[model samples]
Target: MSIFEYAPAPESRDIVDIKPSYGLFVNGEWTDGKGEAFKTINPATEETLAEVACATDADVDAAVAAARAAYDKVWGPMPGRERAKYLYRIARIIQERGRELAVLESLDNGKPIRESRDVDIPLVAAHFFYYAGWADKLGYAGLGPNPRPLGVAGQVIPWNFPLLMLAWKIAPALACGNTVVLKPAETTPLTALLFAEICRQADLPPGVVNILTGAGETGAALVNHPDVNKVAFTGSTEVGRRIAESVAGTRKKLTLELGGKAANIVFDDAAIDQAVEGVVNGIFFNQGHVCCAGSRLLLQESVAEDFLARLRRRMGTLRVGDPLDKNTDVGAINSAEQLERIRALSEIGEAEGGERYTAPCELPERGFWFAPTIFTGVSQSHRIAREEIFGPVLSVLTFRTPEEAVAKANNTPYGLSAGVWTEKGSRILWMADRLRAGVVWANTFNKFDPTSPFGGYKESGYGREGGRHGLEAYLDV
Candidate 1:
């Protein structure tokens, strides 16, 4: 039996039990927005999760005012040890309510429950724990002498990894004593709402970490708010470009963990079986809904055919179904629009004379879903090779030499991350140095660490998140 067949369906009302119709959390209170209310939907089921209040410009002003006020009067003046305690409490609460948070994450964001439970939630807690340790250790970091907090931070995160992204934004900002007003993606707001409650439970000061749920307008409002001292965003290259332009002359510190077209290089010396597994994890994890997904596969021409066969077989075994199922590997696409994007790109690949193949997997009727897809005979010039599809699709291209592999890998404008699968330590180090990406994984892909700084280069965006480096985003050095 498949994993979905044995796994029980999630109750529809579980999110309601946690929280419903979440509003703007400002000044230590949950208040309704001045604008219209927008309904958030479960990407897995196409069902309404809650009617989240949309934050208008006025709402952004209110949030910033509250945050600034708190920064001066409360959060900024609070001792680092006290900040650490609150972060520790929030981390512990997240660990205790992990299962609930996991289910909500999968239901709303269309990520597999296994990833939510084992990967996202755990990392979310660890991010807090790691930053908590750094709360009072700012002097130890090489940020000159006495780096001060940058007042209020405005953060906008993508729909891909809702709570984890929230944690990535909030943890460091709070650790550095910067009040924050964050805008969670409109599609997945439940986890952020739940996070707001966790902050409340941790007794985090009001206006310290406010969550506003809405679409583009709300995010723009937050970014343009005069009092916002720093702007951090995680999303598409297009949006990242706009943000780069928006914050061009401003003194606001900026960090963008944007989109990627990371190359997963499989060398002739690599363990074929292990390389296949690494490739599967690289692109297919989270339904390929990741900024740093290894969407491009650079196989050594010597082992290309064998590696392709092995990878195809491995993909055939992936059970793509309900994300809540423990046994499922790939889950539903985040939304119908995203599914359309994948389909359109696949069609273009076919039209461009590339061979498109999809794994034989049963899909749910209600939600937007796509099978694991791959395009062979893909050249560097093809749209599939160049663009960020942001779906369960891979573009296979072969390279003869290590130099050729590195050239192909860095061909794209994005430099968020890359993967190197090789047995030789020297070759791995050599490739890692050549790859322009900020994060390079040897025999692995998509690994995160709170102590590790993560970001991109060139068009992929600027600055870094995570580790002691993340504090720089919220500090006036």
Candidate 2:
């Protein structure tokens, strides 16, 4: 007898029109870069998606100069209300072009189409709209009466949630009257390039938004550019440190959203079913590529075995396959490099004596893939519990009491985000206060809103993004 399956319900790849080779978006124009070109491929099938121009020193300089010119002559002189009109146009355009963007994002980033469609794209549009509303209201935002835009912002975004991360950095920067030169991760440069077209379609002023497609070197040049008055980055913590160091003596303002090993704690008093779902979503969503993914699961000792049993049952039902598959709950790991990292760390977890449990799912023949994984019998001292495994991997550690939970959770260097599950409001409040994380969710996990400020504390990096707080990053308060 055959079992039930979601079938091959793939979102049509033909919905997006990817060009043969893409150029850098500099000064509001598609221009060829001086550096060598590299091909970006589909991680699921290892098929060449497009050849992208890498930004050279000259390219970075040109983009920065363009942004500086726009800042000095066009963007800065514009009234806040007028600037808002442009932002509103861009936001509306994003909504109008949502389908094309979503398809392209799933292809390039290897996220499930549903996530790209429902979660990522909507949030992208929402961010632009949210910041657009703030464009003319900077004074009343409580950031002071005369907050001025920073000159030229050099933004570097990561591959995970490519368009969403771009939105997080770009929307607020533009709304604050700053011009920007953005460097997208080489593996996921397509969406950023397409967004450049959206900017042009919106009739945004020339040089106001420039996109450079390249790898780490490209990002380095943009970050180190003398003309860039502000630098904002989202990626690994080690890389964030280098960026911070590069801007240390310079007058350039800097903000970074880096790595995390967030702890998701479940109390015995919590609803087991709700906590299990939240825990699953926390580590398995986006193939667990989230910077703030709840990678560490801190379960109360009493319910540890019971919760694991339920969690294992739920994991069995996950559909992992092609990213374009509408029914796919787990997608391909973003890249071969990322896949290797996840593999190495999982091996380390096993070597450290943690029992590994992986969901039974067949991966595609070609492309980077990893089964949904969790390590049981994990201790706070184990590498799996302490380290940031930015993949669909979870490390389970049990705690006897609330204090013990907090103690084990806070043992890590990362302080990006955490989650708690309990029925008691007072206990929720109590756990939240002592978590030492920047964002703490009561019952849910991985919830994001454009109007809410999100950031990290300690080694997870400094400063916030989203809401009125985000405006401060791009402004001269």
Top TM-score hit: 2
Clash pairs detected, candidate 1: 28-206
Q: Against the correct fold, how does model 1 do in TM-score? A: 0.97
Error of 1 at 113 (Å): 0.5
**Full-model lDDT for every candidate:** 0.89, 0.93
User: What does candidate 2's lDDT look like per residue over 1-477, in tens digits?
Assistant: 233677688788777899999999989888998889999999888999999998899999999999999999999889888998988898899899888899899898889999999999999999999999998999999988799998999999999989999999999999999999999888999999999999999999999999998889999989998899999999999999999999999899999999999999999999999999999999999999999999999999899999999999899988999999899999989999999999999999999999999998888899999999999988878888887889999999899989999998899899999999999999999999899999999999999999999999988999999998999999999
Candidate 1 lDDT tens digits, 60-100: 88889999999999999999999999999999999998988
**What's the residue-level lDDT of 157 in candidate 1?**
94
Worst 10 residues of 1 by lDDT: 1-10
